[model samples]
Target chain A: QKEVEQDPGPLSVPEGAIVSLNCTYSNSAFQYFMWYRQYSRKGPELLMYTYSSGNKEDGRFTAQVDKSSKYISLFIRDSQPSDSATYLCATTTSGTYKYIFGTGTRLKVLA
Target chain B: SAVISQKPSRDICQRGTSLTIQCQVDSQVTMMFWYRQQPGQSLTLIATANQGSEATYESGFVIDKFPISRPNLTFSTLTVSNMSPEDSSIYLCSVALASSGNTIYFGEGSWLTVV
Candidate 1:
């Protein structure tokens, strides 16, 4: 099984709708969870980061982690067309430089 | 945040040829990583570059296929040797900032299409 797993979603959502992107990991040693946003032909950009199990809010985006279940999520409120991009989830162990990434979920917010 | 710049932003190379991608960071950092992202796939780490030492590559990656050079804290290069169509992917350079809790940041990426 892959260390990190995510749905390869081309999820289409309307503007102003709430969007939820999630991932599950098989490694319990993963202590840090991150969400990255990537546009077509561009590099991945760090969107949200969380350590351990907890919830972190950054503006319109919220990242939640559940270590018990090895699940992580990124919630976007009032989604916009500009938010259309591929969202990737990454996990890493503490003090490790390498990160395990999910295949990524493609999202498109329509007008 | 460290500003990473990669050379040859986009290139189309002939099969069996080699190409070297350069990465330069605005601030000096101890650790830099090279990653490859194929079409519709997630990023996979190729190797870790540390100044004054040989790069450490991950499984399935070898020094001969993807040799790395870290001559300084802020500059590094990755050469994709004897390329093939399977080598066509976006190569990204990333830096780990110790000051920022080891948060890794990536460059604009070099898009290579091996024909």
Candidate 2:
């Protein structure tokens, strides 16, 4: 199994809908979790960062990590068409630069 | 977050040719990484470029195929040698800033199309 697993969903939703993207990992050592958003032909951009098991909120975006279950999620409240992009989940242990990235979920928020 | 820039934003090269993508960071960073994203795929780490040392490549990636050069703290380059159609992908330069707690920032990416 891949160390990090995410559904590569071309999930479509209407604007203002709540969107949830999730990833699961088998490594217990992972302490740093991150969410990245990438548009067409562009590189991934950091959207949220969380350490260990907790929830972090940034405007309309929220990031949650569960170390016990080895699960991480990014919630987008009132998602917009501009939120149409690929969301990637990445994780790393403390003091490590190697980030294990998931397959990414492609979200399309329709107007 | 450090500002990262990559050159050759998009390119089309013939098969058997090579392309070198350059990465520049606004500030000095301890970790500069190279990543590749194929069409409709997620990012795959190519290698880690450490200043004043050779790059450490990931599994399935080799130095001969993707030679990396880190001349200084704020600059690095990755060359895709003997390119093929399979090599066509978006190459990105990423940096892990100190303040972001391992949050990596990526460049706009260098899109290459090998025909």
Candidate 3:
């Protein structure tokens, strides 16, 4: 099984719809969870980060971590065309330098 | 925030050749990392470049294949020693934030296409 598994979705949603992106990991040692947004032909930019099991909300984005289930999720409210991009979920161990990444889920919000 | 400048944003190289990608940061940082992103795949770490010491390579990657140089805190280079169609991918350099905030910033990335 892949260390980190995400839905490889070209999920299309209309503007003003709520969108959910998620990933699951098989490694139990992973303690840091992150969400990154990548535009076409560009490097990824960090969007949300979490240390452990909890929920964090900032503006229209919310990140949730369920360590017990080894799953994490990102919720986007009021989705817009600007939100169209690939979302990658990454995990890392405490104090470790490397990160495990998912294949990424592509999202397209149509106007 | 550190501003990163990567040279040769895109390149086309022949097989059996090598290309060196350069990454320069506006400010000095202690640790740098190199990553490879194949088409439709997530980023995979190649190695960690630490100044004054040998780079720590990730599993399945070796210095012989991807030699890295960290001559100073503000600059580093990763040379793809081999040219293969499979080696065609995006190469990126990144540095961790100073506050121990766990935030890593990446450069624009160098895209390599081998034939």
- TM-scores of chain A in all candidate models: 0.99, 0.99, 0.98
Runs off by more than 4 Å, candidate 3: none
Better of 1 and 3 by DockQ: 1
Provide DockQ values for all models, in the order shown. Answer: 0.76, 0.73, 0.71
Native contact fraction of candidate 2?
Answer: 0.68
Chain B structural similarity as TM-score, candidate 1: 0.98
Instruction: List, in order, the clash count of every candidate structure.
Output: 0, 0, 0
Q: lDDT tens digits, residues A1-111, model 2?
A: 899999999999999999999999999999999999988878888999899999999999999998989999999999999999999999999988788999899999999
lDDT of 2 by residue, B1-115 (tens): 7889999999999999999999999999989999998886668999999899989999999999999999999999999999999999999999988877778899999999999
* lDDT winner, 1 or 2: 1
Ranking of all candidate structures by their TM-score, best first: 1, 3, 2
**lDDT score of residue B78 within candidate 1:** 99
Residue A67 accuracy (lDDT) in model 3: 92
Model 2 ranges off by over 4 Å: none
Runs in model 1 lying further than 4 Å from the true structure: none
| A28-102 per-residue lDDT for model 3 (tens digits) | 999999998999878788889899899999899999999999999999999999999999999999887688899
Reference contacts recovered by each candidate, as fractions? 0.63, 0.68, 0.58
